[model samples]
Target chain A: MPTPILVVDDSVMARKMLIKALPAGWDVEITQAGNGVEALAAYRAGKAEVMFLDLTMPELDGYGVLETLQAEGLNSFVIVVSADIQPLARERVKQLGALAFVKKPVDPAQIEAILREYGIAL
Target chain B: MNDQLLLTPDQRDALQEVTNIAMGQAGAQLAQILEVFVQLSVPRINITESSSIATSILQLVGTPQSVTAVRQAFSGTLRGEAMVVYDQNGCRDLADLMGYEDDIDRDSERELLLDVGNVLVGACLNGIAELLGAKLSFSAPTIMAEDVEVGRLINPQQLTWNYALLVEVHFTLEVRDFTCHLMTLMPEESIVALKSALDAFMENL
Candidate 1:
């Protein structure tokens, strides 16, 4: 069975970039969410084993998603892929249980490396 | 009171470092939005009274009559406004590059300005806030003026603080001959918080 990955971002352009950057030849089913509300719903529905989250969004943001997931004790691994590449952002996401942080414009090689590190066979 | 005196050399350097990273992120996002390579100019930092903002902008663009401007305000631990200014001719060239049909109307031009402004200003401010470990709520971007004086577009009474820190950068799309300026104004009241945040960030580094 393919692993499910959720990609969340408010920008259509950013979401498209995330999908394009996914590792080739990976047995992965990708789900897309445009904001944090949809992201939470997607996660709760068991549609994602891993999530690529963007910090800035309408409705609920990445931080809000992380906080809610933590409160609910959802154990899915999160990988923050954001244009907000500040050190504080990286630290905060990691503290919130994100497995890794990837700066945007998402680099394919970097995504592949992160996936491999998280034991996803690419 | 000279607002410049409020920031130490170290604080200025730290602010510049943060601005550079933020601008880089903004540039990358902008390139994706426009499907072009963006050339970024060196960032210019100024600490001055809020009333002088228009003067500072005028100095950079020479005259306000040739530019279109968009403004958005953001608040949290930090509070400020971000403005995107594009030369009138540059705005038309950008619309052309974006594949707008010939005979672009006034409404089309305003929409284009707001679209670009939202992307660039929102990204830049979000980047800065992230660096400071702050969450900011942003106002909807609005087109302030089309070919008006910089002074006319800025109202001192609307500023929340008497002084501000301004970070400005110019982006040039060489292929299309499009150029625009992104300016972020952080008010004096927020500088205290910004300085403390920077100190903590530096300490962590």
Candidate 2:
């Protein structure tokens, strides 16, 4: 079965870029959310085995979503794909249980490397 | 129509996302300087007439009694004036950061704000230019207005362009009361280049 993936960002352009950057044969069924609210709803619907989240968003944002996930003990493998590259932001997301931080204009090589290191491939 | 805005709705969204990443770089620079985490709001894009530019700007920065602003001109593939607006409270916080909290006279206060404007505008504009695969250089930041009303902030006669595409970004210090707005105004011609760049960005995706 294909891995269920959730890609969330407020900008449609960003979402498209992220989807394009996914590993060539990741074998994942992808769903998208425009903001944190939609992201949570999708996660609750069991659509987020692995989640790619953007930091700055409308209606609660990625931090809020991560906090919610942590509070509820949700076990999605969350990778934060964000424009906010501050060191503190990276640390904060890690503390909130995110697996990794990837910068904007998503790099396909970087995505592949991260996936390979984590043994998250098919 | 000649009066039609350059960017379509789709283009605007791409431009905003591009700007958000650039703003993140600028915000990180600010966080390093102040040793405080910065909270960035989503970037807002608008295309408006020169006559009402200040009004839209005022609306974005909130309808405050007075505002201090620093303006710098960026020239190259993308050319425009970038303005950094700071409210009184934020200016006070900046004054403190600049170590002028003890005795900030008029000149020192102006210098302090210009100092911030210089760092932020240079970093942010460079980030945007880099992301768009373009090059840009900026003029020295200058104090554009000191505690002025919205109407007096920008004179329509001084604007050489009929329309400008404004990208407004706001950042607030996480632990302090410091807040500022970075607003970029690109004239119609630059918008054409920006539009092409935005299209190219989304082309392969």
Candidate 3:
């Protein structure tokens, strides 16, 4: 079985773009979560290896989910996919143990670069 | 944020003019992203009660089409919220522009909206930041269904029922079926400073 990857965000469009940007034939099982609560549940259920998370969400945010995941001792890599590219936000997510921070207006090349750098092979 | 109250009238006008220019750049960026010819009306500046913003936005959008809104908060030398509101129908146009298939999933919608909001809002805020010799950082956009009742959009603590200065812009794509509005809000105090800023900018021009 391929590695399970989780995509967490509140917007349907954001998830779609992220999925589309992924390398074809990755043989990865991509799961979706609408919010942090759902992300947590999906993480626990699937033991996902990577998570593409959005920062702002109602009823639990990306940061909260990361903290919870840490508490649970789940070591999945987190890649923040957000429109806001504030240096502080980048630092904050990095401190929280995220693997990468990709700003929005999703660039396929950037996404590919990050995925490859992270060894997320297709 | 508190410093907005201290700005002189001249500073205010310059600020407003700066916002106008900033919005113009943002509009251009939107056109580029969508790969459509966009006609954007010069922004109209108004300082009025927060309750009136929705009405103002509706007036700008015209007709009762469902609105798809994305709001993001920005902070730096100037702190405020920027929002991009598009007609629900525009989604299909955006999807087509991105070359996505017709059967786009929920995830695709979120990503597209985020990109849309980022281009419009980011460009506007960044434009202002550059003009003012300040740095601004934006938060991720939060999508919401436009509440015709403007009361739903206000932050009770920051704006309450007090006045806000609104910079509203209307956008029309040349050949596409997409149409939208961009509204930027700031506290009433900023209006005075913004007006002054505009005046100075004009004098220099």
Question: Which window of ten consecutive residues has the lowest lDDT sum in model 1 chain A?
Answer: A81-90
Model 3: per-residue Cα lDDT at residue B9: 45
Each candidate's DockQ score against the native complex? 0.04, 0.82, 0.01
Residues A36-115 of candidate 2: C-alpha lDDT, one tens digit per residue: 99999999999999999999999989999999999999699999998887899999999999999999878999888888
Off by over 4 Å in 3: A1-122, B1-17, B146-161, B192-205
Query: Looking at candidate 1, what is the lDDT of residue B21?
Result: 57
Residue pairs in collision within model 1: none
TM-scores of the models, in the order given = 0.61, 0.96, 0.52
Docking class of 1: incorrect
Give the alpha carbon lDDT tens digit for every residue of B90-203 in model 2.
Answer: 788887875665688888888878887888898788888888888999898999998887557789899999888889898998778788999988888898888888788778
Q: What residue runs in model 2 are displaced by over 4 Å at the alpha carbon?
A: B1-4
The chain A TM-scores for the candidates, taken one by one, are 0.96, 0.97, 0.92
Q: Residue A8, candidate 3: how far off, in angstroms?
A: 51
Per-model tally of clashing residue pairs: 0, 0, 35
True-contact fraction per candidate equals 0.07, 0.73, 0.00
Reference-based lDDT, residue B90, model 1: 77
